[model samples]
Target: MKFRSLLIVAVALVAWTNVPAKSASGVPTYIASAVTDSARPPDDKAQDAKRKPDEVLAFAGIKPGDKVVDLMPGSGYYSRIFGKIVGTTGTVYALQPTEMDKAAPKGLQSLKTFAGTPAYPNVTVLVQSAAAIAIPEQVDMVWTSQNYHDLHDPFMGSPDMARFNRSIFDALKPGGIFLVLDHAAAEGSGLSRTDDLHRIDPAAVKAEITAAGFEFVGESKVLRNAEDKHSLSIYDPSIKGKTDKFIYKFRKPLS
Candidate 1:
């Protein structure tokens, strides 16, 4: 009887010790810190005032020690979050379009300022054409938000679009992820009114990116809205800030 009682106690002790450890492990260690830091608005509030860094980072699947690239990192909105998520061990590359140098007077300077700060010490800002950004090595993840439609816009020219997507493909390591989020348009539309309406057809985006050798992994409807008529321009005053958007996460096939 005593032997059986001792065995029961031993089992209970082991189970008790492991339960808390398992539960603690399930909670992300840096989640609290990341969330707190993200709450603080960036220096350039005009660009990121209305943006949600937490939501975007959650969708991007950012983790500690990840080498991430924030493509078209306008005003370092997402770039700042990525820098914090990746921690000191990981690095973040903030790629700005070469056109910004000509069009945006403070674009390049803003990137430099953010990267130089202690909060974003792990970030590196690169100024190059979206189609042909040069990096020393392939990254674990490449993310572009609200910018994919620019690739198909005629104002950027057809040649630039081809170059941009190809560069995005080359910058990713095999098995790397590419996350894109853009304003949604009606089905069957082929990059229609992308420049004027600030939206793109989901199908057109998938076709173009897939042709560049990325395997379609999956999509999320977290931001989709059935109520959206798909008729009003994304910039229409009514839906300007709250347009339905499509989120896609693609992967480079491991051969």
Candidate 2:
């Protein structure tokens, strides 16, 4: 009897020790134990760029098996990162505006190259008009980086912008997240400087996206810079590649 009791206690202890750690949702955590600590772009060249991959992923709240859409995924920069985070079980859809084929020929070539490579085997590149991107169903997240202001560009126009946001709203599963990051411009300026400065006012972005039926979840200062007066153009030789930026995270209501 004594021996049996000892054996049972040992078994219980072993089982408890082997149990996996779960996240807030009660699902087993899929944290990457080891990630390549490589230097990020924008850092490679002294350009004023967006957030680093790890920082961006954390802010976007990415996880394995989550379906993600990378809007205007130029050169598959963020697409590759999303693919790795989601793992093989997850799907990453890289959306490129058909207009970009003409507007950004270099980016188009890069997309094709990334699609054909095995490194990003799980990414699917979709060349669609910004107005309407045909995705199967609601995704876990829709992410746009440094490109929202482009919606107001004369080439892309208002019609396409409306369609783009509407499509994203429709594509998200209830309770899905929409993450956006762009260079920060002066307050109350709206998107007027987008063409000349390559930046947008944070408030304008919030109003525009929220009007699309998304709830303002939160914002992050991980990429904020106080020294930036938001007066200079993002491409001005002085701050061109290192301008202050804003990060916004929004969520679709669970209706």
Candidate 3:
């Protein structure tokens, strides 16, 4: 009888033990360090709760020596973290679009400053046309977050998307990863909401990327929010940071 009581107490104790925080719970040490790095701006750290950088970096599978291209890296949020985690051997290209410069000339200044600092020696800022993205060398990964929809906006000139995607494909080495994280639109809305709502249909994204010859690997539900009804702009205060987001992973064919 005493043994049975002890077993019950032990089980209860195990169940009541505090669970580890996300950083300590299955997250890689490098990724955890990137997210919690002291060099990160306080504003960037403040967004960590909503951005879930730990989960995002884990999903991207960023390694110590990865060559990452942060497409349209505004304010250098992820670029900064990528630089830290990629370490001295890796390279991070903060590729800013020429069209973006026309729209917001100072948009990339912060990232440029970040890259120039001694702390992020591995990071480089590149300004190139979105229509013909030019990277010095093939990369292991191309990461774009919350800005894929802008490619369809009028301010961007809405270039040939097929060719744009192909450029991304060509920039990657064989079997490279293309991680696209974006705000989710309605089920069948297609690209109609891209300009105004700043969201895109996941189906449309999948179709477009697959048409570019990428293999649809899988998706992560880390940033999903069912409460989002897909009716408002992503900037809407009601659903701004809390909107349903999709993280789609695509792989360039080895052959």
The lDDT per prediction is: 0.75, 0.76, 0.91
- Candidate 2 regions with alpha-carbon error over 4 angstroms: 1-50
Best by the lDDT measure: 3
Error of 3 at 137 (Å): 0.3
Clashing pairs in 2: 47-241, 48-241, 48-242
* Maximum-TM-score candidate: 3
Write model 2 residue lDDT over 79-180, tens digit each, in one string: 766776788788888888887667887876776776636666778888887766788767999998888888787766544555667778899999999999
Candidate 2 is scored at a TM of 0.81
TM-score of every model versus the real structure: 0.80, 0.81, 0.90
In lDDT terms, how accurate is model 3?
0.91
What tens digits encode model 3's per-residue C-alpha lDDT throughout 1-255? 999999999998888774323455688878898888999999999999999999888888888899999999988999999999899999999999999888877768788777968999999999988888889999999999999999999898898999999999999999999999999999999999998899999999999999999999999999999999999998888888999999999999999
**Candidate 3, clashing residue pairs?**
none
Q: Root-mean-square deviation of each candidate, in angstroms?
A: 5.3, 5.7, 7.5
lDDT of 1 by residue, 1-255 (tens): 999999999999999875422114243435435655744464534444345445555556678888998887776767777787788889999887776455554756767877948778899988876446787688899998887787666544444555667777788889889999888888887788587787899998898889888998888776777888778887788887677888899898886
Better of 1 and 3 by TM-score: 3
